[model samples]
Target: MKSLQLLSFLLLSYIIIPANTDGGKKKEALESQSQHTRTKKDQQNFATKFRLYTDATKEDCQIFYNQLETLDKCSFNASLPLVIIVHGWSVDGILEGWIWKMAAALKSQRKQINVIVADWLVSAHQHYPIAVQNTRYIGQEIADFLEWLEESIQFSRSNAHLIGYSLGAHVSGFAGSFISGTNKIGRITGLDAAGPLFEGMSPTDRLSPDDANFVDAIHTFTKQHMGLSVGIKQPVAHFDFYPNGGTFQPGCHIMHVYNHIAEYGITGIAQTVKCAHERSVHLFIDSLLHNDKQSTAYWCNDIHTFNKGMCLSCRKNRCNTLGYNIREERLPKSRRLFLKTRARMPFKVYHYQFKIHFINEIPGKRIEPTFTMSLTGTKEDAKNLPITLAESINGNKTYSFLITLDTDIGEVIMIKLKWEGTAVWENLWDTVQIIMPWTKGTRRPGLIVKTIKVKAGETQQKATFCSQSIDNLHLYPAQEKTFVRCEDRFQGQNRK
Candidate 1:
C-alpha cells in the first residue's frame, strides 16, 4: 500500500517543467507548441518512469521502486553497486528488445548488484521527433533520482553505472551531467547512441566524455545503407569503438524478402536495421559472459590505417579490450579505436599485422595483386591465407595489412610469399603501360620479394623472412607449396 502511494507521488512529480515560462494557459500552450518547432533547449517534457529488476525473466528480486522510501524496502543493498539500464526511441519503450536481454545478462553476470531498467513508455510512444525531445526530460528525472539516492540512502554515485542504447545513451549522459557535485558517475556505456538530431548537439546536449569519469561507446551501424542509421558515427565518448568499420556488420545482410521474413518473423521484420545496431548490446553482453573469448581492438588513427598494419603497436595504453572487460586504465583518451568481431557469439579472433617490402621493382602504375602466404610459427603453421597487396608490389616502401588468424601460429619463424598465377604481366606491363600510355594488359605479373618483415599484433614481435637458396618459391610460377623455412633467413644485407 505504501509502495503504491509513493509511486503515485513520484509519477505526479515527473510532470513536464517548462524552463521558466509565462503563467497563462495561452502562453503555456504556445510554449509547448513552439518546443516541437524550435531547437533542442525548448523541450519541456520532464516526467519519466523507472522499473527495477534483479532476475533474468522476472521483476522477482522484489525491487520495484521509483520512490525514495520504497527503495529502502526494495530488494537492493545501498552498499552494493547500482547499474541503471536505459532504453531509447520506441513505441513500446522498455517493453521488449535490448533492455530485456541486457538486464538478464547483467543480472546473470553480477547477482549481487542492483539493476534498474528505466521505462518511460508514455513519452516514447509518440512519433520519432517527439520521442527525440523526450530524452532530455527522461535524463533529468533519472538524474534527480540519483541525487535523491545520494541524499536519502547515502548511495555512492561513483558506484553507479549507466548503460544506454541509442537515445537512451544521451539520456544516460544527461543523468550523469545533472547528478550534483564535481564527481561524476563511475562510467557510462553507450550502445550505439542515436545519430539523428543529437548529432551536432553540444556536450551538455548529448553523450559526451564529460558525462562520466570513463565513457565507452560502440558503433555497430553508423551510416545508412538501405534504411537510416539510427546510430551516429561520431566519437562522442572517451573510447569509441568502431567494429567492422562501424558501417556494415557481417551477418546482418539478408538479401531475400521472404527468407528475412521467415527467419525474423513478421513482427521482427525490422531486424534488417536493428540487428546491426543491436549487435553492440550483444557484444557487451558477450564480453561479460565469455571473458576467455574477450574481444581486442587496436589504437589507430582511423579504420583505414587500422586495416593496414601501420598502427598495430600497443604503446602507452594504446589497445583495449572490447565490452564489459574494457580497462580504461590501460587505454588512453583515443578519439576512435578500431576492431573486428565475428558474426555470432564467441566473437574473439587473433589479430596479425604483416609488413612486406618488395625489392625488385614492378614498374610504375599502381595495381593491387593477390598473393598467398604461409607462416610457420613456433607452435603451428598457417598456410594459404589469401593476402591482397595494398600498394603495387614494388620498391622499398613497406605495405601492410591487418588480417585475423583464427589459431595462434605462435612465434612466426618462417614466412613464404608467392603468387597464385604468374604475375608476369605486372613486371612487363607497369613499364610498358607508362610507355604505351593506353596499355590494356590485365594480368597481375610477378616480382622478386627479396625479404619480408612481419609484426605480430598480439605478441608485438617482429621477424624477417628471406628467399630460400636452393628452392626459391619465385622460380616455380604456378607450382604447389613453397618451403621457405626459418633456416632460409636471407638477411637484407645479401640482397642489397
Candidate 2:
C-alpha cells in the first residue's frame, strides 16, 4: 500500500509542474506582444526621423539633436500645415524634444500641421554675421523648394507658417521675406526679439523689418523691456512674452535656477516638444486649411504701459494705472520746457523731474556727453529734434535738463536717454522713463514728471521720445463688455 501511494504522488507532481511552466511561458509571450503593439502604434501615428548633413560637425548638442529625431511629427488629415522652425544663438539643434512636444500638442487638436525641424548649424559660436547669412541661405533654399512643391505636389505656401525662436526667429524673418512663391506666407512669430540693440536706433542699426514683407504678423519677447522705438510698427506682434519679467526665468535665485532646469533642461525640453507637436498638429492645420486670420494674443503689463497705444493688442487690455494712452486734445502744446507747474484742473495731475548728473570716481577726468533724437516714419522723413542743455561741468560735475511733455488723456509720456562718455567704465546710456508723481492727486496742476533709468549700458548719443497715442478708448468694451471682465481678469503681477 505504501509503494502504491508514493508512485501516485510522483505522478501528480509531474503533471502540475509542467502545467505551471507552460502557463508562465504564455504570460511572458503576451507581455512582449503588448510592448510591440504600443511601439508599432506610436510609429504609425507619428513619423520621427533624424537626418544629419554629410558635413555636419560634432558638438556638445549633438546628443540633443539625436534625441530630437525621436520626437513624433504629429499630423492631421495625413496632410498637415508646414512649420519651419529655426533655433536661437548658441543653441544646438539637439534639443528638439520641446519643439516636437509643442507640435504634437497642436496636432492632437487639428491634425493637419506638418513640422520641419531645421538644424541649420552644427556649432555654437560668436559668428553673428555668419549665423545671419546661414539662415538667409536656408530661407532661400526653402523658397526654391516651395516653388517646386507648388508645381509638382500642388502645395500652397500661403498656408505655411514660420516660427523662429530667438536668433532662429531673426533668421526666419530673413528667409521668409526673400522666398519667391505665392504670397501664402501669412505669419512670422518672433519669440522674444533679443538685444537692447533695437533701442532708439534706426533700421540701419540692425536688420530692418523690410527684409521680410511676407510676414503679416509678429510677436516679440524681450528680456529687459517690451516695445521699441523702431521695427515693424503696423500689425505689431501680439503682447510680447515677459515670462518672468524678461529675465532668463522668473522668481528668486533658487526658483530661477530651477526654471532653467525645467526650461532648458531635459525635462523642460520634453514638455516643450509636446507643446510644439500639439500646436503644430492641431491649431496650425485648422488655421492653414480653413484660412483663418485670427491668432492667439499675449501681452505684458509693462509693454502695454510702456507702448500705450503703439501696441494695438495692449491697448485692448484696459490697464490705465501704468501710464495709459494719450489723447492729442488733452496734451499741452509745449514749445516751453519746465520742471513743475502747480494748478487745479478737472483731470488728475502729477509732476516729476530727474536731474541729469555725472559723478566721476577718478580725481580729474573730463566726460562730455552728447545727445541726439531722430524720428523716421513713412509719413515723414527722419527729423532731428534738438535737446536743450541745462548745465555741464568738466570732471565730477552734475548737469540737469528739463524737457516738458504734457500728459495726453489716457497716455503717459515716455523718453529714451542715451549718453556717451570718454571713459572705459560700464553702465552709461541706459533707458529711462518719465515718472509722474501726480497720478494719485484728485485735482492738481500740470503733471510733474521725472526720468528714471531702467537699464545698465555704456552712454551713447541719443534719447528717444518713444511715446504712445490714445485715440480710441471704448473699442473692446463696445464689442463685449461682460466678457471683457471675465476674460481679462488679473491673475497676478506680470512684468518684463
Candidate 3:
C-alpha cells in the first residue's frame, strides 16, 4: 500500500509538472495511446524507483536518493560509503537493475557501502562530440549537485567513487574535472572510454587530471571500428581492463554475441533492480583504493608526489605515453606498390590493368591494380620483373596480371589503369615523368609507384611494395603484424 501511494504521487508529479510543454503533450499522448506500450515488467520497474525521484531524466541526480531509498526499503544500514554506477553511450537506464544485483552481493557482506545508479538519455548513432557536449553539461550539473549535497544533504566527496562505462567514462572524467572546481575527485574508473573521439584528439580537447587529482581508467577495449577513427590511444584510460584481450565479450563469434546479450542485456538489467544502489563494484574499488593509498589522498600532499609516490602512478604514466606524431619530409600516407622505378628514361612509362564487372546497378563492382611511388638508387634493371597481382583468388569472376618495362634510374613511369568487364587480360599503362634524383645530392634514383584497383562483385584488394630500405619500408604501413609493448605510461621506445 505504501509503495502504491508513493508511485501514484510520483506519477502525478510527472503528469502535473510538464502539463504545458510539448514534452507534456507527448507524455499525455503516449499515455493515452498506450494500448500495450510498456510491459508489466516496466511498470514494476518504474514503481521500484519512483519513490526516490519524480523525474526520470534526472536519474543521475536522484541516484543518491535512490540509494537511500533502497537501504530503507530493503532495511539496510545507511552509514556506508556510496558507489555510483555510470552507464555508456547508446545504453538505456535498464542497466541500473544489473548494478543493483552486484551491489546487493557486496552489501550482503559489507553493509558499510551503498549503491547509486546513475543514468541519462544519450542519442543513439550520434558522434563523439555530441556525446561530449552533453556529458560536459551533465558533469557541471553533477558538480553543482554535489556541492549542494555537501552543503545540505551532508555527502562528502571523499565517500564517493564513480565507475563510468564507455562514453560514460569520458563523461565521468569530464564531471570530475569540473567538480574539482578546485581539483578533487575521489576515484574514477573508466570501463572502456569511447574510442574514436579520443583517438586523434588531444587531452586538452577532452577531460583530464590536470583539472582534477583523482582520475584513473580501466579500458575494457580501446578500438571503435564504427567511429571516425578506428584506434584509441592507450593513456586515455589509466588502468585499462583487458578482459579477453580488451574486446567485446570474448569467445567464438556466436558465443561472444550470446554473452553480451545475456551479460549486458538480461543479467545486467536484473542486477541493477536487485542492487538499485551502489551495485557490486565496491569490493574492487576498495582493493584499488587500498593498493593506491597515495592517489586516494588529497592532491596537496608532498608524499603523494610523482612516480612511485602517486596513487594512480600507472595512469599517470599512461597519460604521458599517449599521442602519435608524424614527421614531415617523410611519407605521410601508406600504400601498396606494384612497380619499382630506379633508372632514368626519356618517354613516360605506364603499366596498369582493370577488369570492370556489374557497373550498371545501384552498386558497381570492378577489379583493378593498386600502385605506389618510391625513389631508389639501387643497381637493379627495370625489366621483366614479376608484376605480382592477387595471388590465387577464389571466385572465377576474379582477375590478375603483370607487366615489365625497360627503363633506368632517374626516369618517369606513368601507370594508367582502367577496368572494363569484357575480357580476362586488360593491359593498361601509366603516364610518365622525368626522374633526376641522382643528378642532385639525393638518396635514390628509383621511384616505386603503388596503387590499388577496387571493383564491384569482388572483395577489396591492395597491391604491396617490396624492396630493402629500412627507412623506405618504414615509410609506409607495414604489411605484417607489429606491436610494441611499453609501460602504460609513454616511456619506452616503440618497437615495430
- lDDT, each prediction: 0.69, 0.32, 0.34
RMSD in Å for all candidates = 9.8, 25.2, 21.0
Better of 1 and 3 by lDDT: 1
What C-alpha lDDT, on a 0 to 100 scale, does residue 70 get in candidate 1?
A: 62
Give the residue spans of candidate 1 off by over 4 A: 1-47, 60-69, 91-94, 224-228, 254-257, 263-269, 329-334, 361-368, 377-381, 422-446, 470-476, 479-496
Cα-based TM-score, every candidate: 0.79, 0.36, 0.37
TM-score computed on alpha carbons, candidate 2:
0.36
Among the numbered candidates, top TM-score falls to 1
TM-score of 1: 0.79
Between the candidate structures 1 and 2, which one is better when assessed by lDDT?
A: 1
Ranking by lDDT: 1, 3, 2
lDDT (Cα, tens digit) per residue for candidate 2, span 22-59: 44432332221113222222322221122211112221
> What are the runs in model 3 whose C-alpha is more than 4 Å off?
1-79, 91-93, 122-129, 180-183, 210-212, 224-233, 247-249, 252-496
Q: Could you give candidate 3's per-residue lDDT for residues 1-496 as a string of tens digits?
A: 3442332234223323333343434333222111213332332222112112212232222333224444345432234565556665442334544345444444443546655555555431233334444555455445554554465556676566666665666666665766644536566655545554455555544444442334554333332323321113354533332322223222112223344447767544322221211211332333333322111111112211211112212222221110010011111221111111111211112222322111111112233333332222133334213333443222223233423233323222222222222222221111111222223343322222222221111111222222223233111111221111112221131111
What is the alpha-carbon lDDT for the whole of candidate 2? Answer: 0.32
lDDT of 1: 0.69
